[model samples]
Target: MPDSQTLGNRTRGMGEIVDIAGKTTEIAPFGNTLAELGRERPEIVGLTADMGRYSDILPFRDAHPDRFFNVGMAEQNLVLIAAGLSKVGKIAYCTTYSVFVTRRAYDFIAIACAHSMANVKIFAGMPGLLNGYGATHQATEDLNMMRGIADLTIIDPCDATELKQVVRAVADIPGTVYVRNLRGKVPVELPADYKFELGKAKVLREGNGEIGMISTGYMSARGLDAARIVQSEGHDVGLLHVGTIKPFDKKGVIEFARRHKRLIIAENHKTTGGLASLVIEALYEAGVYMPVVKIGLADSFFECGSQEYLEKKYEVDLPRFVRAIREGV
Candidate 1:
């Protein structure tokens, strides 16, 4: 296991994965995608809360210097300015640490953006246990908090392929959209031709109705790997990647759940009020009940450490996922 300093130097605050040993990685996919999109859409503008380097918005700032804005360290001002710009016809793409945006700028996002249906796309970096700064910096509950805002489109992309698609997808999506941004050397887990659609879930792998796994964010990548591992052991498993959290694919989830005997819900957030809770809510309301093993953080403030350490300590690592599927709990 690498130390925090070693992992931080390699991942640059992004989550560390033990399984992606030789997978292709993309550097600054968000910034490159925004810069490319800004060429065709002059109305698209990038803003960061003094997080250009870490948030990976510098490429946009370099490509369109005239359209980029850095609102210092004030997260509240970041959302407010993005919202203000959206009202005046420009599509605002803002970046910041997820913890600051969700915790400090909740009111601005809820009222100034979502409440008015502003075209402000918030790409929040260091979501969940990705950051080594721990609770103060990890936006583990961001989905739960942001999902409460009506009309807000919340998405937790799976990898570099999906993250790039999300940046372009949210540009045309009316109203405020919140994304759990993945920065640094993000793995290219999904297929290159994968198309991202809002409020839809993708079935990554099919099984024989024995076990099903629903996951969002980077956890989707882990779930895919775990599913394959469990399949090799003769236990059929299916993997559903739910990138969009709010406006969730209830029909897809219910349909997928109905095919499987048991379910495993995984996320990089607390088990409460996040992906696990959403899956259960949808299943119960649809009358598709089954035994579920949740893979996520506990209902407690996590301590600062490397991503590998924290994930293992909280029992959300790949091994835990594999065990959950193989053991049926």
Candidate 2:
């Protein structure tokens, strides 16, 4: 483990509670979230490639059975079917594994969805090491793949708070969207009222003189833990919870980066085209110079392991995260 002195100057705090609307309700995974979306938008239809129950689209299927469609297990068929539905002006939220949805249905997704700029929201399950189902199931580089598709909207939500709100926001909205979803035990990390302004990053913890760590998805939660440990050693640590990956919030990130010179970017993925790439692009465009440390899985194929094991190996775990902050700069 690295020492605190080696961790460089700190910036962010532990985290913030966003005071979500309604009494803090523990919502079900895919079911209630979809059902709520259906209630909010009449044209919002649910589709899954034989994962209605597994992906949590059962409630929507049960409630609005007329609109919901299950195109069996073929991912290609799933995309074309959803695209066909979108032609009739329906907002279709397709559910499938990240690999099956992005890789298996690549051509169909490109031509049927992106070519026409259809409104198909892909609710992808098991991003990165969320599942130990091996590389066949893990979508560690889905962002790098999908963002390459033209006119496609990429939103990798950090928690259920933004997930629920984004579901409503993309309902019937134009263009194709790929959203990474957390299935079970998605701790209410972000506050309920956490805003979902498109292309915006939230300052979960404000740093005084320490490094600012910007993160997305489950790793942001882990980053919070890392921040706590570093602060105990009397370092100022800050966190930037970024929800939108594509069409990223450049100004907001530049503003956050301007506050601190030493920066750390943490994600549950390779330091490739995910958060790290986005931050570097933003800083380059802004012509702002700063020392940035990339704390994430490196650009290599990760072997199969338990979720905890993979997290530790990837250094996105709390203890490793603290060490990365200590060593990154």
Candidate 3:
């Protein structure tokens, strides 16, 4: 484990929430990937709500300053401008803090972008508990809020590899897309050859009908870690990484659930209206029920703290995951 000073220093300003111990990482994957894509696609435009640095969109802005627009801290205006750009035949890629986008500018997103199926791609930074700036910044319920918007495609990539893939994928996907963006030294947990498909869940590990784990966001990487730990103790554990939130892979989830006797649903957001809730709802609709453990935030606002402290205090750390796999929560 990293010391408090190390954790504090790493999470000082617009830093990552997850510990990157002994892992390969990419710096500014989102911005760099978008910049690379922007060079090829002239119709793609970038916008930010005064969060270009924090959201890691500066690379895109640097590459295409003529097309990059900074709407100065107004999330609503940001969405409206993006939607308007989309209406003008431009694929507008807008960014801001997840909490601000979902909480403050939700009406604009719902009405202007989603309602019209605009070609606006929203890259929301600091999703779930990924920020150290407390409840005001942590978008613990952004998934819940965005998933309800009709015609909105929500995605939560697990690592830098998938995040880059998603940045490219959404460009061709014609409609409103909401992505939980991971920035600043993002870990490369997925394989280099991994392909990210929209509306599909990828199975990372296979189990022997004993225990299966379903996870989204960075929790998918942690789920793989926990599955390995449980496997060492003679329990067969499987892992399914669900990158796409809305337009969820219900068939894949049902098939995975049918294979395992017990299941564990893990996510970075709240357990009530996030990934866990979606999985449970899918299982219930499919008439597949079993013992299930949910690993996520409680239905309460969190206080400002280091990612290590907050994850441990809220029981979403790696050890907590190992415990949940060993002894059902």
**Candidate number achieving the greatest TM-score relative to the actual structure:** 3
Global Cα RMSD, each model: 2.4, 7.1, 1.6
Arranged by TM-score, best first = 3, 1, 2
Report the poorest 10 consecutive residues by lDDT, candidate 3.
1-10
Cα error of candidate 3 at position 40, Å: 0.6
Model 2, TM vs. native? 0.88
Candidate structures ordered by lDDT, highest first: 3, 1, 2
Q: Please, what are the lDDT tens digits per residue for candidate 3 over residues 157-219?
A: 999999999999999997999999998888899988999999999998888888899999999
- Model 2: per-residue Cα lDDT at residue 34: 81
Maximum-lDDT candidate: 3
Q: Which residue pairs overlap in candidate 3's backbone?
A: none
Candidate 1 lDDT by residue in tens digits, 1-329: 21233553343244433334656788888999999999999999999999888899999999999999999999999999999999999999999889999999999999999999999999999888999777788888898899899999999999999999999999999999999998887889998778898999999989888888899999998887777676667987888999999999999999999999889999999999999999999999998878999999888998777787678888988889878977777
User: Which lDDT value does model 3 have at 128?
Assistant: 72
- Candidate 1 runs further than 4 Å off: 1-19
Candidate 2 wrongly placed segments (more than 4 Å): 1-27
In model 1, the clashing pairs are none
For model 2, what is the error of residue 223's alpha carbon versus the real structure, in angstroms, after optimal superposition?
A: 1.3
lDDT of 1: 0.88
Whole-model lDDT values for every prediction: 0.88, 0.76, 0.90
Q: What is the TM-score of each candidate against the true structure?
A: 0.95, 0.88, 0.97
Error in Å for residue 152 of model 3: 0.2
